[model samples]
Every structure is written in C-alpha cells, then in structure tokens.
Target: MRRTTDRTAPPTPPPRADIDQRTAERLPVTLPVTYTIHDPAGPIEGTTVTSNLSGTGVGFRIQQPVAPASPCRLRLTLPQRTDPLHFTGRVAWCRKIPHDSPQTFEVQVGLALSTPADVREEPSFATYCHFVASELVKRYLG
Candidate 1:
C-alpha cells in the first residue's frame, strides 16, 4: 500500500478590518469589468462588475479564482467615457463563495494598481488613477 499526500498550503489569516489599514477609502462604485487570468489550469476570462472602487485598488467579482500575485489584465469601462480603460494589474487578493458550479464557483478579486502598460494594452489605467486623485483633492480643497 502506498500513502498519498495532497499539496495543501496553510490558510492565510484574515486581515483585521477594524484596523482600517486601507490608505485610500473604497467607494461603492460599480463599473464594468472584463478580466483575463492565466493559470496552470488554463486561461479564464469573464465579464463582471466591480463591487467597489478605490484609487489604489479595485474589487470585482469573476468566475474563477485568480492566483494572488499573478498578473491579470482588465478592461474597465468608466461611465460617460467612450473608451474603455485597459491595464494589467497584480492580483492582490480573492475570496470564493460556494455556488452551483462545482469547486470553481464565483470569486471576488482584488487588483492592485500596477505599472503602466508597456505592451498589449493601453495607459488609461494610470490616467484613471490621476483622475481619482484630482477629484479627491478638489472635493476636499476646492
């Protein structure tokens, strides 16, 4: 008889939300989200909506679990903006919920603001950041 062991990792401890570690406040802003993730299983792509938005990061729901620290591409459609913003971001976090689709159920993903797009994308992501920052300054100062 042979013994088998599954490659399981220790679960990451949940963050202390009470601490309010966020640098920028997240707003309940819903925008369009089309994301693509490349994993060992394959490439996963889906159209979803953002759960929240912030200057430093974005929270959106997708169909698959995107590995943390992986580079994921996203196209965000801002309201009243005719052009969709395309950018690549590092997967900051994700949480999955049990759904009808086996273990690969719905998962919410968080993406950190990464570097400007160099290829296969545009630089609108950085522009969006600037727009948000300016808005904040205006609201508080102006």
Candidate 2:
C-alpha cells in the first residue's frame, strides 16, 4: 500500500454555493432581504427572502442573474432589529436554475460582506455572527 501527493497541483475547489467552502457554519435564518444589483445594463431592484446567513455572507434568490463580482447593495433586517443592516459587496456567486416550473427560472445569489468588513469593525454583523456561533454551540454541545 502506498500513497502519493501532487504538491505542485492545485487543490480542487468546491463547486459554487457548496457548503464545504463556507468558513463559518450557516444558520437556517430566513430574513427579509431587499437587493439592488447594479447590472451593466441598468440597476435591478427586487425584494426577496434570505435563504441562509453566515458570518461571511448571505444567500438569497433573485429574479435576475447577477454577474459574479458585480457590486450590489443589500439591506437585511436581523431579528429584533427594526432598522435593517446595509451591506455593499460584490456578488460572490449566482446560480440560475428552473424553479416552480421548467418555463420559469430563478437565480440564487451569494453576497459577501465587503463593506462592513472594513468599516467601524462591523459591530452589527459581528453581533449576528456571535449569535450564530452561540446557536451552533447549542445545537452541537447544549
């Protein structure tokens, strides 16, 4: 029995939206999301529900496909917060697939937190991340 390692070869990357690539655990927290994607043609505005939340990003479905790395503005309201948290980040990924019917299509987009990451230490987002960490602890330990 023997094993070999390809040191020079790059490691395989997980597919887009794959859970394995997430550095933090995702909370099945569905929050209200209002997004404005600045597409090249024009700005697309829509309201959709968040599918999941993580320390690094948020996932939601959009009516139109957002190009990867395209800048976008996201307004999300966390639990017990009346004023929504505003985030500006490039679209991490977008997956277009058929939904409800074959004739209809929806795009699921992942938006990374870029602005708040460098602004004011991102207190609001940090708080949410803390909450997620605690919930994960409760699920796995408590």
Candidate 3:
C-alpha cells in the first residue's frame, strides 16, 4: 500500500497563547522538581523536570493535565544547592504539546511563583534564580 500526500495542504495555524512570550528572561535548564498540586479535597504529588526557569515562573512537563490557577508547592533540586528550594506557585497556564498522536503528547504547565515575604532574605532561592538568568544571558546574549 502506498500513501500519497496533498501538496496543497495548508499548514496548521499556531495557538493564540504562544508560550514563547517572555515577561521575564528564562534559561533553558533541566532541574528535578517535586510538586504537590493543591486541591481542596487533598493534594496530588508528582515528580517532573523543569524545562525552563526564571524569576517569575517555571515551565515543566507532566503526564497528566493540571488545571489553570491550581496552587502548587515545588521543591526544586539544583546542582549548586545542597537542600531543595521550597516555594509556592500558582498555575498560570497549561498546554499539551502538538503531536500527531494525542496519547503520546505531554502536558506542559507554567507556574507563577508567589513572591516570598522577604525575597532578599532567601539567599538560596535568589542565588538559584541568578544562576539561571546568568546562564541564559551567557548562552543567548553573551
């Protein structure tokens, strides 16, 4: 059997909410982060790796879809830090990767972290953010 493609087929239009919008600069780094989804009934916990990191939010992948505006607790494990950095964040958006097969697609979640009472006081968190931002600048702009 032979399959033929239509040369005149139109390309699929991109989604309206493009994830490329960067309010804050982000670095492409992979870090393991344990997250607990905050639900009224109970909490659902899972492990995932961060796709990118920035001062405001992080993008990570998950096997299942998480609702937008869901509060979550993240414990990020960075190579420079001995102890995982703990923080609270709110789900800003959720999108599934466009794949030919729906079953193989992974859900990407963007979380906007709630500012700590004293960001200056949290040296480790501040250091980690600086590290990521520096790396991003070094790679792209430096």
Number of the top TM-score candidate = 2
Off by over 4 Å in 1: 1-21, 99-105, 117-123, 134-142
Taking every candidate in turn, the Cα RMSD to the unseen true structure, in Å, is: 8.2, 8.1, 9.2
Q: Show where candidate 3 strays beyond 4 Å.
A: 1-22, 39-42, 98-100, 140-142
Candidate 1, 80-135: lDDT as tens digits: 88788886777777777668867566777778766544522535856687666665
lDDT of 3 by residue, 21-134 (tens): 436776677999999977455676899899988888888987666666779999888876678888888877776765697568777777888876787787756866777767
Which residue pairs clash within candidate 1? none
Global Cα lDDT for candidate 1: 0.71
Ten residues in a row with the worst lDDT in model 3? 1-10
Candidates' lDDT values, in order? 0.71, 0.73, 0.75
Q: Which residue runs of candidate 2 sit more than 4 Å off their true CA positions?
A: 1-22, 115-120
Error of 3 at 110 (Å): 0.3
TM-scores, all candidates, are: 0.67, 0.74, 0.72
TM-score, prediction 2: 0.74
Q: List clash counts for every candidate, in order.
A: 0, 0, 0
lDDT rank order = 3, 2, 1
lDDT by residue for model 2 (99-142), tens: 88887987777777774535448876666666677768887899
